[model samples]
Target: MKRREFAALGLASLALPALAADAGFDGQVEAFLEALWRLDPDAAVAAGRFEFAPQITLPGSAQRDRQRAFLKHWLAEFENRSDATLSVSQRMDRAMLIAKINSDLWQLDTLREWAWNPANYNPAGPLDLLLNTDYAPLPERLKALKPRVAALPAFYRAAQASLAPNGGVTREHTELAIQQAPGVLGVLDDIAKRAAEAGQAATFKAPLAQARAAVNGYGAHLKRLLPSARRSFRIGAALYEAKFAHDIQSARTAKATYEIALQRREEVLAGMQAQAAALWPSVIGAEAPPADRFALIGRVIAKLSERHVARERFVDEIRAQIPQLEAWVRDHDLLNQDMSKPLAVRETPEYERGVAGASIEAPGPYRPQDKTYYNVTPLDELTPEQAESSLREYNHWILQILSIHEAIPGHYTQLVHANRVPGKVKALFGNGAMIEGWAVYGERMMIESGYGASPEMTLMWGKWHLRAVTNTLLDYSVHTGGMTEADALDLLMRQAFQTEREAREKWRRVQLTSVQLTSYFSGYSEIFVLREQLKAKSGPGGFDLKAFHEKFLGYGSAPVRLIAAEMIRS
Candidate 1:
């Protein structure tokens, strides 16, 4: 079936079960998604709950406790239903819902980021997801904006109350939150300006002013605590392992997974070396290794960097590649193309920078016609040196692979397919592991299908994949084994073969995040293995790459293991 046809079915039948579950459990899933969203309005908005767009989540212990209770009640509901009688897809959903609730419980009880992470208190993420996505008309969305603005003061007040006393928040978290809150006011002003242009300013003016004041005040509250902020951010080995189990939703313990990443790092570097050796001289005007594999590959990669687009044109460079990427995907039949799912390549909004080099903001499942934003951060804000460093970091070959990962056959493509999955609950609560892993796998698949067309492209992908592997190593080592910034930089630069600039940024990123860095490698590893296994079993002409991807994606972003299990059962 065509993608548009499938999407129409999904939109038309969101309330219907994706599989033959105990019919009771299907209603149970929708109830849980709604209950979960009502508690965390930020999540509700992201899930395309336009009704919740105006609600800023109340930041306090009570909220967490209430959410925990909700999770347990629904978790029990799903658990009580017999898996034995369920279809493979229904069984997978059961596992995901269970893992999700368990993960949330761990975070609220053990991880307790709410007490110490000021980043969670930032209003920008929710505000951006609301104001940026055109899920509703400007007038209507601006009207929804009032409640969030009115709630801002209390939101920050709850943040103050919930945060540990005496600046117990991480210095990085506090500093970043303080930096970001002020930006929320700017978004409000932009919205007000838009309202005025649309002759709807009267509708937005009062709340806009009030929201700006609340945001400014919130910034000051954070700024005052900056001096006493704790430098410690590690979640420790025990909690790290638990989070690994929950977030990654895999059986492998954190340490075991880190070891696997370390091994993959070596394998990827070796591949890069082999590719570099063949393309030597032609790449860097040299024909042989420099006795050190790391330096030799770095030299060739440097040549690729020099061939990069200028900083001024970086965003345009990314936009220009989308068509070529789409063309390539179609020509290769890498997967079914979904032209009906609109993807727009655009500059990253001011409030969303510092998070990624590139990212995709897919329309919420409930709001299907809205465009998916392929946000590429422009180099305009960076210093000349920073801009140049970033350009080299995302060089031409690497950029194409990045495009493939973030756009064509990566996040955008998978989400296009995901939105058409009949169950709203599954689409809303997607497993990050499957989403990211599929993108990483897509990168490798594209290269294998001859997308890059050059050894340099393949080598860049090798190095990029190494970054995924090293990310796991870096996260575990820093959080569990007490790896220092110098040590992490060496792991990223020399071992992972990343640019010095890229490695430095990663040091900051690891400080900001935990287990999440590991997802790309872990998910990709399992998905790739699953593909090979299915191929071996299918035999001869039975295996179809396009069909595999479609069916795998059709599962609606469940955990990779569950997705794999469903495929195995089939």
Candidate 2:
């Protein structure tokens, strides 16, 4: 059968109460994912492991042994399955699964964050997932959550055993985990309270207390381990590149991604300089401003950033724009509208704060029918100086483009379309590069299509796009080329034209993350190129932008190259 036919057939099978698949191809894939979910039960809940929600996957040697065995079994299974025997969709699913399994093994055996990062052991979030997703009734989910919460003390004890005395975790990670641990406990405490409100607190009482104690004790475990913590959180070059291959699921190498980003950065910088020069007569006057193009661009972008929302209004302003952004996209017919797909604009969950400005909480592949939260972190926690810096970073013009990136035609838009895909495997193990790339591409797509239709918006888009480029550059440089905090700040604040607070926070982020920072640029580059190819092929008036977008998003969040091949295939 053709790919689309297979996808439809596969999806129909998913709706069945019991797992059933085609005798050969779909059967193998279904069996593998089922086993994988049971093994990694916490990840399973979000990925539609409704049956397994009550169980938490404990971290430690026993868990790792199971993970190892699982990985080896899958690799052997893949070896026996010949591509020639399978349908196209089967081949694609098998390949993606193999890559994911390989990535998992590499992450476990090689990079080994579990050996280092104590935060990986946190079980509070798993229960939160069960509570929030609404795949079942509240009572049913609460029942599922109880066992997971009850299991936390044992989970953390196993996690504690997993940590090395003198290991790889940085002091920063330990400290952050210690701080965030409380917030996680708060989620559990709230769950117990909510259960009490519903007269089910007695069911949650013992586990909730034990879970809170486990979290606090975990915090203490980290505190004791702090002196032994090392600062080298960088996954190093070889592991970084290997992890990138699987996690990113793109053809680009780390070095190639870095080089492309450098070139893209220069391209964006040149565009911003021209934009700066155009506005120079009014903004900077008829005199030579700065010798360097980077500094000159920075000066002009700062002027555009001057019109920002007040610190207090930051969250409200962003919240207020969701409806307006939705309307604008509908007005423009940017993507096929899904009025039923619930997109919620809300405060970033307390347990998930202290990260990027905003992110999307999409339902897992198995549970497609759930609310998608567009989480924007409020600025109430920041100091005055910090708040000012952050506001400057997310100024009025940039905020709209950000809304486009995170909500309108970006993450929220792409994911709604993604959920419509019949291929669960594709959505379960989405290409990070493509997922992030689509959102970054969405920013430019809106500006180019005339949202604001002005130079300032164009300038802000350029500056924001530069962040994508800089992210990759920083990721590669920090891990491989030995970029320092001073270097990172200078690159982000000066050349990238980001605010001081933003630059400092980004420095912290790069250290915590690995090749993930590179996904935005790498995916965007491939996607933008693909769009150009489509546009060129269709020719000016013949090119249907809306059709191109739907086709692009229709493939779900697979690697851009895969989508490109399928969309433009003969």
Candidate 3:
């Protein structure tokens, strides 16, 4: 059976009502979300649980089911509200709430299907999202573990049922589950030990004991389930098609989307190459092939590192600049809001893992006390030769561009603002394209605004933009099984001007994940077009970089088309 067949079984059209009327529409929506947070404390903490009540224990699956049913019933009761009865803002808030609940329902149902995938099941990903990395004190984290530990039995039982005789559980999934089971158990054990050491309540102590027994039972259950896990099944193409539709959230089929992204990538690459040539005549001698651009970039990086500032110094510089950036936004009245929390720059082991890297770990919807992290990995891991190679590739200009991309006026700042948007549903459906796209867009915007005034800096930014385009092409090529590792490496080396190490790292990332690479080019392209359109539309009114940015982020991270509609309507 194809993957889509399973998706089709779960694909039901979401019902979205027209604008609604009610004097207290906004209040009702807020109350609904507040109630939801109370029921699911993990979500509440994630959504800014610190601001509301103290941390509550997460309920088990049966309790969650009852809560979901109650929400559905409440939504049904409020479904007939018409716009005429409510104020404009209240009506808009209600519509957003309804949309959010529908999206949440879809997510809950879809999660059951993908639950076996280690990416979804392991503590590293979704679990990390809920753990409040930046917010919730250590005591809160310790206290919250009781319910998660308590809930392990129910999770295992669900897994067992899903793996029942002739069910859809695959051998690969079962093997991964088995492999990850020990890690899961270990996490639970760690949590229990921590809670006990912290002198948590008897309520917590009792649950931890129960969790240990349940985990042991789950291990036994897994052995029974493993024997019946099949190598394959008859999931039809229709199901695969449906799944693709839901996952991509676009009208185009996956194949079509891949193709469009491929073509757009080539166009962007050509444009960037032209821009690079014009900006760096001495580096490439004005008529060099696109492949030789990396050598120039490498030389530039090597020169920069020779004079590179220490990490602490660089961070201090960024910290000092924040006040000016923040003031610029306020003076311009961009978005008409202030950040709920200040941004912090941090170094972490995880960020160090990526070869060509930096990342923004933004606050989630439930993460009110969240501190945004702008993580920049050092080049310490590279072999001396690899280090030199990377240095050449990441020159000073490139470093500045990356800083702008990952920190100030980029992902971290943009997301901090995005999280402050008033609606819960908008926050939950945040798309990667908008987030990454805006950052990439910021790099170019800063260059155009003279943030990094040097010709070398401009050229380096062009090179990275070119790489983003190349990434999109390689992602589609490798995943469709059309491009070999060697071919991918050669393309990166030739067109994007990346080192062998950079190329190989990208290949590994593509192998581990699909669809994410496309976001860079897709997002950049959309932002580019939007900027042009905004420029044209505004005329003498002109484009306010601050205003454009604030407005863009205010819409959350939905598709550019939806964002465009919202912008135009507003």
Candidate 2: list runs displaced more than 4 Å.
1-23, 85-87, 284-288
Q: What's each prediction's clash count?
A: 1, 0, 20
lDDT of 2 by residue, 1-570 (tens): 001101111011112112333457777777887887788776777666679877666787988999999899988898778877664445556777788888888888887888777666656556677776667777887887777778878888998888777655777677767867877977887797778777898777777888888888888889988987985877688878888888787777889888888888878888888898888778878788887898788888887777899998887898888888888888988776676778787887777665576877776666566677778889998888888888888999888878888777777777767666655777777778888888888888888778988878888888899999999999899988788899999999988999998898889888767888989888999998888888888887988888778767766667887777766773
Give the Cα lDDT of each candidate. 0.76, 0.77, 0.55
Model 2, TM vs. native: 0.93
For model 3, the local distance difference test gives 0.55
- lDDT string, candidate 1, 54-163, tens digits: 66668787877788788788878877878887766677778877877787777888788888887777676666666666667777776777678667778878988898
Which candidate do you rate higher for lDDT, 1 or 3? 1
* Model 2 residue 356 distance off true place after TM-score fit, in angstroms: 1.7
| TM-score computed on alpha carbons, candidate 1 | 0.93
Give candidate 1's error at residue 283 in angstroms: 2.9
Pairs of colliding residues, candidate 2: none
Ranking of models by lDDT: 2, 1, 3
